[model samples]
Target: MSLDQAAAVMEQQARACRNMAAPLYADLLVHTAEDVRAGGPCADAVAGWTGAPSTAAVPLRLLGGVHALVLTGQAPQLARFYPSAGGAYRPEDADAAWAAFRAVVADRRDAVRGWLRRPPQTNEVGRANLLLAGLLHAVQESRGLPVRLVELGASAGLNLRADRFRVAAPGFAWGPEDSPVRLPGAWRDGVPGWLREAARSYPELTVVERLGCDVTPLDPGSEDGALALRAYLWPEHTARATRLGGALELARRVPARVDRVGAAEFLAGLDPRPGTLTVVWHSVMRQYVPADEWARVTAELDRLAAAGAPFAHLLFEPYEQDGRHRFQLRARIGAGPERVLAEAHPHGLPAWTV
Candidate 1:
């Protein structure tokens, strides 16, 4: 691909970053687009890619690589401007930040190039806010049976421990009170009154098993794996960084198995256990799956339902609504029709009643 076209992609991502409240990433991406147009080290790092620059989440991968350098203390000068690196962004320091970032791309070309090849996997903990709510509905539907949590495209399975995190909103609360990963204002306008019955339908969820699948599953307990998860988070979003820290700790304490397999194959290998609520869950990752593979996954869900196993499919995936994308929490219980339970931010914070 021509550098100009690649540069436009970066600029497009910058617009998205700005809209997502990541101004630091937006500014840096502008500089990155310029660097790409100039055929600088950024171009060299992405040289190996042939099909398309966006095939590997080009912009996020590039930013994640730079974030890794800051997190690892390999780019101290650049780290000084990254919030997640314990530094702050200053407009006056923009030129210096770009210089340091470019130097990292130039000097650590191999490292940056390696990051370019890997897809960005953030394993966002905030999304657990929506996951937990859906689990609540599942638990209620299963007649309070023990939950068997199965997730598709679960990166490090940080969110597999969703039940372990504490979620609180106005006049509502759930999960352990003393939990480290505290999610406040989980529901928009303080837990909508319409869904109070479902929220209180079950005393508590009893999770018996936690299993997930990813083409490339990450080990949260390992340093390299953890760094990859952290690197993908927007550096300016300190709240997400803190939430990740808590989720990582929860992952250590809460044992969950993430199989290194495709979502369809993973679902194909499982049978629902009797007297247990099999809750199949996934979030945001649905977009990456091929249409045929995703159809197979849905078919597997259908198989489980036909088997007469108490099952629920809870997902937080984007759906087109009114000519735009909407991140929705959809749930299905025991072959019943799927229900659109709620809506939330892309990061899955502050959900509102549908």
Candidate 2:
């Protein structure tokens, strides 16, 4: 890279790392620079290098794009590359940080060309909800009772409508014969049906609370709120965008309201009412919560569990495994043992129960 090119890269890196503490950013930059030099995916993407390069540019650009879209809600020229339906270029419609990076590169022209040629894969939003349903079933089985779920990071609160919104795993062979979110396989057959039936048996099994916690909570009632929900979507997941729209409509119909609050503080104050089967569930929420806040949340939960609190908690997290994203389901009671219930695709296509 030329001196100017190197300087530009450094400047971008500095800005990207600014959110972290200064000391942390310095160390992170050093390690990240080394990782890029070693041909990491991050490095290649930013430098506009081609064919099996690093992905460093990816996170910065994507995150930046999301921020840009969230802030502006305007048409991004970068949308040409991603080509998502439903106003993908409009920042306010969806999360733009990732999308903006492409536009940012488009302006760069000289340095980021090669990297911008290919867009990152969309995170499968639909699959994520499917995994949550199975996790709910597993938790129900463990507790020996129907579950009343309370969700954190509810997003548009679509997953909370699992029963009402029809779903099918086109990629797998397990689920209802007539489903709305049709994918590529036969239904997982037995348990899913049983769970569905059980779900129906209790029409009055209301979600005591299907609330969410967002530093910036999204209220579907507002146009901007709808856009923020759009900004987070990856362009490749058309099905998800469709489903999100549907969920948004459902949310309007029932309006599953989310309480904007700190997760740790929220849980701390929540004394699950006696005899109520409360399941404190979080799906893909831990990553966003700050480390200190996360520690506090866990600590509070531990205190509740120690008291033999009448709550069954389920966590559905998608993490990288062998260069791919996969979901894991684990259940715990207060500080009790966290039992690993299943591991599957981040989307609901494939899953193996423990």
Candidate 3:
């Protein structure tokens, strides 16, 4: 993309990120802003979003007061535009202040756009869901009991513990006959029944093994990490934070077992025992891997499967430009076709049939 186009895209992304970030930091913006300005992934992330690398660093400091104002929930519109620590705009001039902020951003659009050019993560969740559902489906197809799952990008391992959550359908239906927590997401039209049947059919599913992969696994109970997690949430998504907090509680009690490893290489060396079905899965982790590494990973998996190794691969991933998250579940049983049992969502919420 041209520099200008790239800039626009960056600005667009910033706007979207703002929608998610504003609300998250409202409660602890003042305290967190200090943390944000201290220089870390969070600070870098905020700077990246604002598009002013030089001034980008400043936003982190402002985060404290700006977020505190938001948490107050009174005339937040003005607080959002003019942080409480004395600004050019008075609280009384709400509309004008917002307009002014927009104007400032518009003037700096080029620089901001340059920084916002990171790849989009839109269909990532959908892709993850698709792969997950397909893996379970494969187990049922084989009449296997008690599946084992190993995932990359465990992200608090929430999805890894998906079975523990109630998955529902449109007509107020649910899955896992005796699941504990209710999952939160919009299920596809027929997904509930399909999922329910999948569960019943795979009654043998014991989930003997479940683990995840991540460079840094966030702990909600940790005061420091909780702030970071909250900041990552979108301002418009209070419910998501609440859900995340709930997930955190579950995590503290029963966290996703994860192993730190390089994505493709890690899976390559992993050897599954005979008769014990080994599955390798990932959700939207491709973006993080370099092309060469991704190629190596693919080749490695192919070799293992070709050797007649008893293994399956599930990928719930998306191709962003098309806005489609295809579920691709491939299994190797004897010298047979690289079977694709199903394709669902990267995140499994609002899934589509492929």
Candidate 4:
């Protein structure tokens, strides 16, 4: 890519980070994009990143590498700007931090390049609240049948243990109150009557099978895996980091199998079981899937739904509405039309019931 084109992508990512409530990342990425244009270490690290702009996610991957260095105590100067290292994020310190970041990249070119080559796996546990809300809605509609969940792009499969996490809205709550992963005040508005009823009727779901697929899955039990997962989270978001730690602990006790396969390939091999609700779910992952493969995934979903078995497809993804980006919880059960359950935060908190 041309220097101008690369800079444009970085600038676009910076804007997105700012909109997504990650000012620290926005400042660093904005500076990194300028450094790229000026022919420096930042540009060298991101060299050969040929993915399309929409699917690149290059900025986060680069940031993750830097964060890893900071976490490992390899970049002490840069650590002062990272909240995860017990430092405060001041916008005025961003310029000095960027210089330190460039120096780190220059000194650790090989390590940074390795990170850029790998796809980012955040494995956000907070999103499980929104995913569980969708599952509860489906369970209620299916009349409390045991659910067999199949998740695409499951990352570390941390969310497979979502049922074990607690969530609280204004007037309703679900899961164990004493659970390690607690999502207090999860919803933006008052919980809907349907959700309340579902939570009341079934405080916990009967999940017979928990299976997930990802082209590259991380093992939450491994030290390297845990480090990589934590590195992707913005240092400023302490709640998210804490939640991830809890989810990792949960994963140790209750293990979920995540297959190393693409989404379409995994779906093609799945067969819905009788006397159980077969639910296919994904969150914030559809954007990474290619159009042709996603089309195949949709066809497979339709085929599974038509097999005379109880089935549901749930998604938490961004949908453009009225010229704005809104992440929505949508579901399709059996042959029924799609339903928009709620609008949610990207990290899966503060859901507004619709």
For model 1, residues 65-99, the per-residue Cα lDDT tens digits are: 88998999999988989989889987788788888
lDDT digits (tens) for residues 1-354 of candidate 3 = 322332344344444344444422332333233334454333443444544442222333333223333334433443444332223333355445544333333444443343344222111222334554666665765557456677876655655665554555555433445544444454554564445577566643566677776655544456744544543344444445455555555557655676656667567767666666667677766666768988988787676566654567666554544574354434444334655544443334556444
Cα lDDT listed for each candidate: 0.87, 0.51, 0.49, 0.88
User: How well does model 1 score by local distance difference test?
Assistant: 0.87
For residue 63, what is the lDDT in candidate 2? 34
Best-matching candidate per TM-score: 4
Q: Which stretches of candidate 2 lie over 4 Å from their true place?
A: 1-82, 86-131, 142-147, 169-205, 307-309, 318-326, 333-336, 347-349
Candidate 3: 10-residue stretch with minimal lDDT: 118-127
**Top lDDT hit:** 4
Error of model 1, residue 308, in angstroms: 0.9
lDDT of 4 by residue, 186-289 (tens): 88868877788888888888899899999999999999999999999998898889899999999999879999999999999998898999999999999999
User: Local error of candidate 2 at 21, Å?
Assistant: 34
Better of 3 and 4 by lDDT: 4
